[model samples]
Target: ENGEFKPAYNDTIKDYNTILEMFDRILNPDPMSYTSPELKSVFSKFKDLFEKHYEEQKELENSYQVQSNTSTQAIKAKLS
Candidate 1:
């Protein structure tokens, strides 16, 4: 957003924390002009973090489905 400065924060909570934590250093960056190699490397890790979230979401969905099926089967057996 900052003329290709590429702030990793934007609108994401994950990225927000990334930027917020380093706000002091970035807000008054040196005029050499500016760059933090460490920040870039850490931001690149977003992909893996999101991937882990996706896997957990899938696991939660599958477990709910299994519980629903079990409950349905139990009800049907009572009617039989």
Candidate 2:
């Protein structure tokens, strides 16, 4: 069932968020450093990249779900 896929997808999202947070911390280091426009620019770029990849992943997941549903319907139709 589709419900079974949710837990795994949620876990993946949690892990991805954690990793991004860790990277942000590593890149920014301190609040004072965040005051620097250069540091802010770099971190912003990193964040943009993270969001791009996250969106791509979500699109891929949606495509897979559509394919799965279509296949399941086909199988059910064949059975009945």
Candidate 3:
């Protein structure tokens, strides 16, 4: 087994929430009031980054699940 610890689904949720909270704080006092083009651009970039990381996290979780299932199946096959 690898000595590294992969992030779990809960961990990703916490991370995503933290990101949102940070952005909320940044735009606090009137988040909807930010209508400037530059602020919109920044917001768009943040959204893109969030989406990219979410996709990557989803893939990692899926791969981890597949690996776990395969290992279980292999063990069962051997015991058969």
Instruction: Give lDDT tens digits, candidate 2, residues 1-80.
Output: 85555422345446777767766765666655444668667777888898899999999999999999999999999999
Relative to the unseen true structure, what is the C-alpha lDDT of residue 74 in candidate 2, on a scale of 0 to 100? 100
C-alpha positional error of residue 25 in candidate 1 after TM-score superposition, expressed in Å: 27
Indicate the TM-score of model 1: 0.48
User: For model 3, where is the 10-residue window of minimal lDDT?
Assistant: 6-15
lDDT string, candidate 1, 1-80, tens digits: 55678754565555444644565355345566464767655554654575578779989999999999999999999999
Error of 3 at 79 (Å): 1.4
In order, candidate lDDTs are 0.66, 0.76, 0.73
**Cα error, candidate 3, residue 47 (Å):** 0.5
TM-score of each: 0.48, 0.58, 0.57
Cα deviation of 31, candidate 1, in Å? 28
**Which run of 10 residues does model 2 get worst, by summed lDDT?**
4-13
Error of 2 at 29 (Å): 13
Better of 1 and 2 by TM-score: 2
| Per-residue lDDT of 60 in model 2 | 100
Candidate order by lDDT, highest to lowest?
2, 3, 1
Off by over 4 Å in 3: 1-34
Model 3, 1-80: lDDT tens digits are 38977633335446666767656654452655545667766876887788798999999999999999999999999999
